[model samples]
Target: MSSFARHRPAQPSLASVGPNKLTQQSLAKRLLFHSHPTDELPPIFLSETLPPELTAEVYDFIALALRAYINPWWTKITRYDKEFLPQVTHILVIVIRALELRIQRLNIPALVFHDIPTILSQHYADYRNALSKLSTSYASGGAASLPQLFSQMQPHTAILPDGKIDPEYFRQVFDYILRVCLPLEDHEAEAERIIVREVIVKVLLDDVLPKVTQPWFVQKTILDLLGPPAEGEYMGPLSAPPSSFSFHNLLIIILSVLQSFSGACIALIHAYKQAIITIKLVQHSPPYKSSTLPPQTGHTGPPPASPVADQSHTFVSPSSISTTTSTSSSTSSHPLQQWGSISAEPLTITQVGGNYAAPGLAMVSEVFSTRDRFSSNIFHIMLTMLSISITSFLDKLLPYLLLNTLCPAFILNITRLSKRTLFPNGYPGPQPQEPTLEEKAEIRARLVAWRGEGVLSYFLPLILGPRPSETLGAAVDPLSSAQCNTHLLVLLLDRVLMGLFPELADGLGNPSNS
Candidate 1:
């Protein structure tokens, strides 16, 4: 027998001792054996059917060995075969569970967190190397064995079982890795943490996303995790309820994706576009409509007169009305200024969307319902991505910008409506004052301009006419800002095109804008 096998640690008898009881003993022996500079490492016994305790121990040994004993040799290590990589994935399933459950009884060390990223980075590198070799070998081998070579090129059966990718599986893996890395966000460890994030992001964008049946679904799910919960509905993978801490972790991952991957801009934008359609469908679905509608008053005509109506009957000059409006407007233009000022400073997930803190970021307001924190986070993410896409990738994004801003339906969805207008079935909440004559005249002029623009312009009023939603927090109100920002972004894109390609800009203008 080989010297390595001659000194192999004997497996403890299962009848006399449980696997959990021997964890420290196993770790100590593995660490001692691997620490020697000249001793050959023992063969790793990895199998899909390995017991959970054995799997965890194997991974823990690999992790500790890398950190404590293998650093110098790892750079020169032979590349693992594709089959080996998938078995590594099986080992990871156990680590993922421990991290997810916050299990404290595991004999895993702190260094293991650091080592996990290192192992993943190396595994993917080997995977890529194997693919490169496979392609090269196939190219030179000729058509005699093309069918067999093609079969070899198919994604590993272990990773893509039944030729289908499970995006949630990857998501769980990613979430756990990032959650473990959160404590390393400080300056001293930030660089190392960033490297790990970049590696994971590269795999996500280049490898995983391209293979998925619907890449958009994966993107939407990630954003959904980072955002607030859906109203009257749970939002998550159904593994856990939405929480602030998880949202914060997810946000970090997303920010890393944006920073690391050049193609993420396009992917996220497409996801946002898909989100617009999905949310609109959900909002109009029977469940949302029924849940959000105010109680019936049984009267459809004009509202019954009250003492407030009696006060309104006392005539006030249009000039006085204009003066008072201007004064109030000049003093403050915030939609919720009457209620109170809101902080614009960056907020922790805890301070995001509600009075009570959960596990993630939320925004709340005393003036309006702060229930839809997910909607709020989604909006902020959309705005950040739009700004980045427009400013940085304008050339590639021009087509998207045109569709979002010029398409009447797209515009209508992004703009907020008055509470009464939006929930037409009934609205018992605060009602905004009626428009003054000047305001009415302005509206009419705007309508006329819209009509002059052409048939499509008729829909612009619905898009732009609604007052902002009364919801006060960012988590609660996202669409109003989206409407304004998207309009500006398209206009900016137009001007940039005008400078670069005047003919293109000329064709891009809306009739009203022209």
Candidate 2:
């Protein structure tokens, strides 16, 4: 037996087996009833198991579908051999169903109610026709039709077969149309205009008008949104009828309130002045006084005796004695006593007749001086308080009024203007008259004249300015000359492009078309 085994081919070991033998032995039981390799695996196997070549083909189909329907006009109707239409339709339907479910969950009413159904119904016939063509082409040496594959795709008995179209279904359809068809449509320009108009109207009605009525708040919010207004630009409301509330009206109201407060301040100042004047007049009035003196005895005896004895002498020299007696009597009489009393009493310089003496005037002057000083200080204090109060009131009130009233009104006005500009015929309206030829011509003429008078004089000077020379002897250096030429060329190009296509020109000259 050992000699026979050596002579015969050494029994083949399991280690020497090829892959074909291993496969046959290992898979033989699994492949018993199956003719193809794929028939043995689960139907819902992961795409990761797919061969690389098959994955690449699937990717190509997806890319082609995406690009082809991007513009509906670009669909390859002329090529009957292409079998991609049904596959694209299948993908679109799946996308639409997914979108419908999403919109239904979100509860977006506009898309559900207004837009979706219209889009789906309109595109449905075209989709069906494309699918039919793809299937017919596919049956004659092409890929299997989408419908056929779908029918074979593990019967979807679990899903309900109800045909009732949901509003959400339409929304999904519109979403798909926007994603796929809108880019491909030839009516993009018109569609864009319509969209812009709609957005403007919606914003005016919903956002802008409410803001206008509260001008102060609106302005602040707008500043926040758009940044500070440019210098010399309309930072406030536009002119309109007084009956129509605006930002300016709120400003006027604030000013009126300030004026009233100022009037109150003026009244207060007047009251203070009157009080000072009264106090001064009372201070200058003189005080009253009373006085007494002892009674005086008459100088009788000696005077009489001298008079009798010297009568004869007096008769002899009557003229001299008469004069002497008269002098003595006058000196000795109550006139002296009255003079003494008058001297003893205090002498007050009172205002006699209508005129005041210097002393009397002094009292008036001193009182008035005090009064003036007090009045001045009081007036200053009052003025300062008035200013502070007014400022404080305004600081508080202005913002409150602006936020609560002015901003909303201004926003409303702007909203109205926007509506007029966007949807002139949405409400009852007469068409606005076009500008007269004379007016148009006058405007044009004025513009042209203004431009001709040197709107660009500064620029011309810079361009024509003298260039730096490399050496005093050298004519312009080649480098400098070249730079000058380049500058001129760039300037010329800028002007030409701006004149021809102002919209296309940015800081850079027109961007390269390529």
Candidate 3:
């Protein structure tokens, strides 16, 4: 019997209190012996499921183990699989929560959107310090302790059950992003954090934002979180945590927002073009006289889109149609002929839009309406328009140097508009003093010159008119030369086309016309 007892392998003490208790204790002992104590954690660490103390313990243990205990041997054994990266980031996120808790319990200043960079800087500094302490600990322990490596690591399940992401998902995203900005090799301890962030943000921004069905709301939400694209504009301090702290990602997002804003400007231009068509309908109608009355025509045909609309429906305007139909001398007497058309160099800017407002009439309505975000939204459109104008000006190498002097005034006008109070919710009904005759005349003079020798004219020569090589004869410089003088060309066409001959009213006889 003594020999049999010696030969038998020791049974796990299963005859404890009860069968269930024995089973439970034996299983616990098996796990305790097989894996690190921390590795035995439940697959999930959700606050909804776990007690606060348990959650805190899980978070603290994971962060402490990863950052404070770098085992070169253990790290070498780590597979560094992409699948497990998020787990590391998850651990880091927990750590962040811990820091947040520490701050809150200690009554420290809570972070805000504007404090992203500062918070990131702080987080990184804290990480480095933790790493430093780990390095010291590793050196003291001679880097050979296997148990220390396992001490805080919980044994996770083979298949981690999926669940909802934490409410602080945005914070987690940025935390992982911070790690991704660094290479995997430079920071061995933070590889998991980097991988996790890449997955989270990829799912949120790349995969989700572009979804065919739900992308609109998602994209708009992202834009709202990031704020506007304009730099140096004070975005009154946000009390909530910053959506993202990385300048690298922030710049990309800002450009996206700006691109959307640019589309809005183009859409506005289209609305103006449509308005112009409506105005033309009013202008060409019969004056309702017995002499002019004829047969009632059911179809006058669809009003032809303005030729100067440049094929874009957005540049239409009521005033522009009036300028088009009126006599040239009459148009010249107005404040600015062809206002949206830029004096009818046949320039038309197209409409643009995206998820926030679809690219057509809806977008136009958004800009014109003064309700909700219209004021701020319109300001963005205006800013984008000005930027586009400036870019076009530079692109053309700043044509018509004499007229370029007026650019400062245009810029000042835009600045003044930008600083004005927002339009009220319903509509902007503010009354303004009409322009004086002298002001009208001056503006008309500038408008006439702008449409002639301005950069628009310069581009028209290349884009639509004959090229320099295509010129059949010695071409007199349009801006300068004796060819500026022409009388019969100006007088002969007036009876035929009226205001359509604005080029004729270019002060052909004026010596300083160029």
Best by TM-score: 3
After superposing candidate 1 on the true structure, give the runs of residues whose Cα lies further than 4 Å from its correct spot: 1-33, 36-181, 184-187, 214-514
TM-scores for all candidates?
0.17, 0.14, 0.19
Q: For candidate 1, lDDT tens digit of each residue in 234-268?
A: 23355666766678898898998877686767778
Candidate 3 residue lDDT tens string, 335-388: 111122111223121211111111221222232221234343454466456646
lDDT of 1: 0.31
In Å, residue 462's CA in model 3 sits off its true spot by 57
Write down the lDDT that model 2 would get: 0.30
Could you give candidate 2's per-residue lDDT for residues 1-514 as a string of tens digits? Answer: 9898789976788989866567752121122212333333222112233244332233333333333222244354444423333333333333333322222222112111212222222222222333465546544555655333222221222111331112332232233233322222322344432332333334433343323323233223333553432343324666865697789989999999999999988988998998677545444432211112111111111112122112221111121113332222111111101222212222111111111122222222222222234443454445445645564333333223323342334534554554455345443234334447675444333322221112344432222223211111111111112212222222222222222221121212212310
Q: TM-score of model 3 relative to the true fold?
A: 0.19
Q: Name the runs in model 3 displaced over 4 angstroms.
A: 1-34, 37-95, 98-190, 206-514
With candidate 1 superimposed using the best TM-score fit, by how many Å does residue 8's alpha carbon deviate from the native? 27
Looking at model 3, report the run of 10 residues with the lowest lDDT sum.
Answer: 289-298
